[model samples]
Structure formats: structure tokens, C-alpha cells
Target: MPATVTKTWKLFIGGAFPRTESGRTIKAVAGGTVHHLCKASRKDLRDAVESARAAQVKWAASTAYLRGQVLHRLAEMMQARHGEFVDAIRATARITPRKARDEVDAAIEHVVCFAGWTDKIAIVLGSQNPVAGPFYTFSGIEPTGVVAVLAPDASPLLGALALACPALAAGNAVVLVASERHPIPALVLAEAFATSDLPGGVCNVLTGDHGELAPAMAGHRDIDAIVAAASGKRATALKEGVAENMKRVQVVDPDSDFTDARWRSPAVFRGVTECKTVWMPAMA
Candidate 1:
């Protein structure tokens, strides 16, 4: 071997990979192999939020059926690149190939499941309400604009997918912060997404320290909500950061079994969605 070149992973923002504006790099070591990943700063977080905000409206405007198709296409892309995901998870997570394969399989399954829900969510989340007067009232679900997802340190691929798929299913733009310790899998998934039908900026991945970015995500004025897997003091800090704007915060157990049946529930989308009640003339 003449020379060894290490690749510095870039942040996925607005459907493109860009080096962090802060120009900081963090190293992740796995089995004597070192990987360089972008260290996203507060400024990077702001930029991700801006991209998400810009994409949210158009994404939300797409027909539910189209959104469902796009999501399913993402699943197909993941399946196509299944081996890459398995290897990434295995290397960073230090798991057996079989276990890594399982995680990748689960992640693909999770994406397909959420793809089905994109169209069905309205049926589960919306309702026709009884009105007192000669008016028809309906409650419909709407995307919560831009959402920030903080992936759990463990099960990097599955954990990130579990949080992100729901928000995407509900037609919200996402700003995903991959696991600090093992972010390669998330970035790998980002590559699959890049080739999929997902609109640019619809799902952005930032690789960096959650401790540094979570508070920034919580306090960001443009981010409408946060879905994170954290506990104890880490969880508390995230919650406290939302005091100013009161952004919707949903903190799940970091050790949550992502394979749990509850992940499929329409209720899972509630945190990242809003209910809009419309009243119209009965004749119309």
C-alpha cells in the first residue's frame, strides 16, 4: 500500500453535502480504523433549520399519495444499498455481521412501514366532527413544519430511522442529528436518501455532538418540534432549551426497542403534527 487516504464525511444539508462552516472535524475510531466526520456547529444547525423551513411548505403541499410513493422509493433505495448499511453499522457499532444485517433489515422494514402510513395517516389522525349549526366541521392533520431528530447513540441506523420516518410520513421537513459515537450509518442512509425521490432539504443529516446541537435545536426559532432519544440530564437539557418558544419536544427512551409494535401507531405522528379544524357551509 502506497498511501492511505481518509475521507472526511460532509454534512447533508438541503440535499447536498457541505463541509461544516465552523471547519471543525471530529474523529471516530472503530477497531483501529479512524473516520473523520464533520463537527457541526451552532451555525450549521441554523443553516439546516433554514433549509428545512424552506422545504417544509412544498413537501407538505404534495399529495399524500405522492408522499407515500416517495417514501416507498426511499425504502427501495435502502434495500438496493443494503450491504453498505450493514457494513457501516457493523464497523461503528462493533456488532457481528449477522446483527448488523438484522439492523439494516429492520431499518428497511421500518421505512417501508412508514411509507404505507404516509397516505393512511389522515384516515387515522383526521375526523369528521359533529356541528351544532348548519355547518360541517372537519379536523385534519397537518405537518408541524420543520422537525429536529436527535438519534440515540445505540442502534444508530434503526434509532435514527424510527424517529425520522414518522416525521417524514407526516410530511414535515427533518433535520436529523446522527449518533455522536457512530454516525457513519446515518450518513450512509443519507446517501440512499439522496438517490431517492425525497425532495432536497426534506431530510438533512448533521453529524456532530448531540450535547452541543440538541440545545441549539431546541432553542431554534424555526424548528417547530424536536424528537430525540435521550434520558437523565441529557433529556433535561433538551427540555429546558424549549422554554422560550415552547417547541414541541418528544423525548423517548434511548434504549427503546425500535422494533416495538407501538412505533407503527398513528399516535406516533402526533408529536410532529398539528390538527387543523375547518368549518364549512353544509351546502358547500
Candidate 2:
């Protein structure tokens, strides 16, 4: 008889998988089997921020159409591995197979839906300003650099995909903290991100204690914004920490259903972008 090899999960940073610098691990027991995942520390968060910052420039420079294509590719990859996600979600959360399948379906659809908005966000969110001068003034949207995403605990895969897809579509790089309670699904999703056309660091995933890591993400100087899908004390802590940097923070209602059609719109893209106005003198 051959001995079974259990895989150890690592942090996905800058397109590479690295063990936590803290050398800490967390145990995840599912179906009488134990899985170990890296316990990311403050140093890991800092490194992810740096990597995201470096990648954001290029990602933002890409054409909106190109970004949309990349997102679409991600959706395709996720759909191809649909079964794996369902199993992962089922195992970690101990949810019914039907519910797990629904989550995976919603997640795939969420990515595809967001992909369609990548090229249209500027049109929907930006406009020409009427100024009292002979000038062409227009307002446009730009990525808010690196963003920190705190995935919700209730629906790990769906919540993480819901938050991350729009941010990436809006041209911002993200450092996503997977659900501390159910991170296996997120780990599987990271594999999809790697195989997709997403650039390295554009969507990094870390599994660890959210209570310990959420503040690090919020207070980091390099992080430009946060999409926090947390509630109660965790949500309060994240919001308060971002106050010091005045970073743009959007707190998702933890009770809200991430699979709702309303969440799949262009609205999520607006949260991770900054408005820029350009004025050009009209030909006289």
C-alpha cells in the first residue's frame, strides 16, 4: 500500500507560492482528514502589498478591453474546474452538495458578469463635465492602486469571487484574505487565477487569521483602498484602521447574498476606482 501525500497550502504572492515567513500553520479538518494552510503574518501582508503595487501600474495601463478579456479567460478557467470548487466548498464548510454546487456556479457567473463590465465601467461611471469655459472637460475613472479584500465567512468562494472579480475588472491589483473559517475553496480559486490570464499579484490569496491580518491590510500605507466583506467586530476594526490612511473602504453587508444579481453589476467596480478629471482648451 502507498502512503497518501497530503498537500500543504501556501500563500499566493507575486504569482509564486511561498510559505509564511512566520512559519505558522493552521489545521483544517474535513471528512476526517487534516489539511494544513499557511498562517500568513504581517510580513506576508506587507510583501503582498508591495507586489500588488508593482503590478498595478501595468495592469492599469492595459486597455479596458484587454482587461475584460483577461477576466473572461478567468471565468472560463473556473468553469472548467467547476467540480473541484464544489468539492472544496463542500468539504470545508460541510455544506450540502447542492449548496456547494450553487456557490461554484454563482462564482463562475460572477466572474463572467464582471468581465463584461471591465470595458464599460468608464462609460457608466465617467462623463463629460459642462464647464463655463471653452474647454473639453471630462471625468474618468482610474484604478485605486492596490486594494485589500477581506472575504466574508458565510460564503467563502462566492464572497471572495464577488469582491475580487470587480476589483480586478476595474484594473486594480488585489491582496485577498480568504475566509479564515473556510479557506480551502479560496485555495482552489487561486489555482484558477494562476492559470487564467490574470497577471501575477493582480489577485493574491492568503489564508490565515482574519482578525490578525485584516488590520495589517487596512493600515498599510501602500494599500489604496479596501473591499471588506466582513461584519461585527471584524468589520469595525478594518474600517477604523483605514481611517488613519483615509483609504477608500467599502464594507459589504455580511448578511447580503453575494449571488444576487444586483451584486453582479458595474456597481462593485466603482468602489475600487478613483475619479479623475481632464481639461483641454477647446480650439478657438
Candidate 3:
């Protein structure tokens, strides 16, 4: 009989998997198996922020049509690994197989939904403004740069995808903090991101205690905004920490159904994007 090889999950940063600088590990039980996962530290968070910042510039520079293509590729990658995601969710979330499959299906569908929005956002959110002068004025949307995402403990895959797709679709880079309790699903999903056509550093995943990372993320000067599936003190900590820099912060109920149609609304992109208005002299 051959011995089965176990895999140790590492932090996904800059489109690569690496161990934590702190050399810390947390144990998680899934599918009657114990696995070791890298426990991210403040330093890890800083690295992710740096990576995201660098990538956001190029990602935002890409044409909206190109960005949409990248997002669709990501969805295809997720679909390729559908069964693995379903199993991970079932193991860690302790949900029935059918429910787990449904979550994975919804997550993939949401990614495709957001992909369609990338190209349409300008048409839907931008506008030509009427000014009382001989000038042409218009307002357009731009990415907010690096965004930090805090995923809920339950529905790890769906929650993370739902919150992150909006930011990515808006052309912003993301640093995602996976569920502290059940991170297997998020880590598994990271594999798909690595293989997808999406550029490196566009999406990074960290597995650790949210309490430790949320405050650090809030105070991160480079991070332009945050969208968290959290509430109570955790949410409050983020609000208070970002006061100094006035960084944008949004909180969603962790318990909310990520598959809801509201999550797919174009309004979700507002927080992740900045609206800019420009005026130019009109040619007669």
C-alpha cells in the first residue's frame, strides 16, 4: 500500500504560495483529516498590501474589456475545480454535499456575473454632465487602488468571492483575509486564481485570525478601501482604525446570503471605485 501525501496549505501572495514569515501554523480539521495552514502575521499583511498596490496600477491601466476577459478566465478556472471546492466546503463547513455544491456553484456564477460587469460599468456608472458653460463635462469611474477584503467564517468560498468580485471587477487589486475558522475552502480557491489568466498580485489570500489582521489592514496607508463581511466589534475596529487616513470602509452582514441578487448589483462597485469628473473646452 502506498502512503498518501498530505499537503500543507500556504499563504497565497503575488500569485504564488509561500509560507508565513513568522513560521506560524494553525491546525484545521476537515474531512476527518488534520491539515496545517500558514498563520499570517502583520508582516504578511504588509507584503500583501505592497503586492496589491503594485498590481493595482497595471490592472487599472488595462482596458475594461481586457479586465473583463481576465475575470472570465478566473471563472473558468473555478469551474474546472468545482468538485474540489464542493468537497472543501463540505468538509470544513460541515454542510451536506448538496448544500456545499450549491455554494460552489453560486460562487462560480457570481464570478461570471461580475466579469460581465467590468466592461459595462463605464456605460452604467459614467455619465455626461451638462454644465452652464461652453465645455464638455463627463464623470467616469476609476479603481480605488488596493482593496482589503475580510471574508466571513461561514460560506468561506461564496463570501470571499462575493465581496472580492466587485472590487476586482472595478479594476482594483485585492488582499483577501480568509475565514479564520474554516480557511480550507478559500485556500483551495486560491489555487484556481494562481492558474487563471489574472495577473499576479491582483488577488492575495491570507489565512489567520481576522482580529489581528483587520486592525492592521485598517491602518494600512496603501490600502485605498475595505469591504468586509463582518459585524460587531470587528467591524467597529475597522471603522475606528481608518479614521486617520479617511480610508473607505464598508461592512456587510457576515450572515447575509452571498447568492442574493443584491450582491450582483452594480451599486456594489461604488465603494471599490472612485468617480471622477472632467471638463474640456468644446470645439464649435
Candidate 4:
């Protein structure tokens, strides 16, 4: 008897299944066999950005509390699907089941922790400044609009979504380019987001032609920020590419304490970026 295909997941764009306009497909392998096809195309990216732009205004206007609520719901979803996520990790990252489950747990906890910071980060990272005169001056942390993330290829399942949540909780629309060779987990993430009330393109995940698409994302004008992890000569290339648009780039130091749970603590670095202020009494 032949196997029955009950369902096939499609690219999530504009909250609908608009297959790749270019009709491109990439294969994913497991246990030395190809078992899945992921879609990709230039038009798919365009449609994703369009979906993100459409919801950007309302999403940005929504209060931090509301955004946090959605994030909390996402955490709940992750916990329920823990096994599915671990399977993805074990296959892609080639980790033992025990280690894979640990990574999955870390990913989920990272989301739950980051979500809680949504309402309190600004208060903690934000501050009031002292001016020369009665003119009041203050700075509150704000989202950088649309963010694009190129997840670390080495730690696909855990590292990918780990970065995605922080960007979303900060009120930015994110388009993640998943690992090229390993994509099952990325697709699973897409399914999670689709049902999580993330409002479509807010968290679009595309897998294919990453070497070509990632550099383009850094240069695209619509991408306001990027958080990528890289090392070796490839890391150098990523820096050079992102320079094209001067996107707010953050290069994760490979040898740094990021792997340490302390550095991973939400209150430590999730939304703690700094900003400089200049005042000359309004140029007199």
C-alpha cells in the first residue's frame, strides 16, 4: 500500500498559502533520505514583507502588555509541542535525544523569559536624562521596526527561534532565514507561528538560497535591524554585506558568554541596547 498524504504545509504569506511564485523547491534530508520539500522565491520574500508592512502599524501601536500576552501564548504552544521540536533538533543538529530535548527546553524557556520582559524592559533599560535647563528630556526604549535574523547554522533548532522571540517581543516584525541544509525545524516553527496569533508575516520563516538571500536582506532598505551569529571568513562576509545598508547590526561573539545561562538571562541583554543623546540648548 502506498502512503497517504493527509497534508502539506505551504508558505505562510499574507495569512494564506500562496505557493512560491517562482515555483522553487528545496529538499530536506533525514536518515540519509530526502523526505520534505521547502519553498522559496524572490516573490515569496516580497509577499512576506508586504504582509509584515500591512500589520506593522497596528502591531506597533499595540501596547507592550498585549504583545507580551501573545508571546506568553506562544510559550504555551511551544511547551505542548516539545516532542516535535526535539525530533527536529535530533535530526538536524544531530544531537542525542537528551541533548535535543535540552535545547528545545532552552528555546521554550527563552521565549517565556523574553515575553515577561516585554512589559518591564523599557522601564529597566529606559531612563530619564538630565538637561541643562527646564526643557525635559527622556528616552524610552523603542522597537527598531522590521528586523531580519539569519540564525546560526550550527545550532539551527535552538539558536534560530531563540533570536526570533526577542525581536518579536520588542515589537519588531521579523523575517527569519532558516538553515539551508536543515529545514524541518524551521517549517515546524512556521506552523507554530501560524497558529499563535502572531499576525502572519510578523514572523515569516523562509528556507532556501540562504547564501543568496541573507546578504540581500542586509542590504534591503526595509530591514531596520538584524541579529546574526557567524564566525570565520563567513562572518567577515556577513559584516561586509550588512554594511550595505548600515542596518542596526549585532554580531554575536562566538567565544562570548552567550551560551552561559547568566548572559542568556532576559534582564541582562534582551532589550538593553544603549542610545546616545545630544543637547545644545536647541542651538540657542
lDDT of 1 by residue, 1-284 (tens): 68977556899999999999999999878668877889999999999889889999999999989999999999999999899888788767768899889988999999999989988888988999998898999999999989999999789999999999999999999999998888999999889889999999999999998888987887787888999998888788888857858789999998899888898888799899999999999986
Cα-based lDDT for every prediction:
0.90, 0.87, 0.90, 0.68
User: Which segments of candidate 4 are over 4 A away from where they belong?
Assistant: 1-9, 232-234, 241-243, 253-259, 262-284
Instruction: Residues 1-284, candidate 4: write the lDDT tens digits.
Output: 99966335456665565566776677656666555455677666766776776776677678889998888888788888889888776665667988778777877777777778788767777767887685556776667777767676655766776666667777778777776666667667777777777786678777767666656665676766767665665556567755676667665653343346653454443431334344444344
What lDDT score goes with residue 209 in model 4? 71
Number of clashes recorded per candidate: 0, 0, 0, 0
Clashing pairs in 3: none
Q: What TM-score, over all chains together, does every model reach?
A: 0.96, 0.96, 0.98, 0.85
**Which segments of candidate 3 are over 4 A away from where they belong?**
none
Instruction: Tell me which residue pairs clash in candidate 4.
Output: none
Residue 220 in candidate 1, Cα distance off native in Å: 0.8
Scored against the true structure, residue 153 in model 2 reaches a CA lDDT of 82
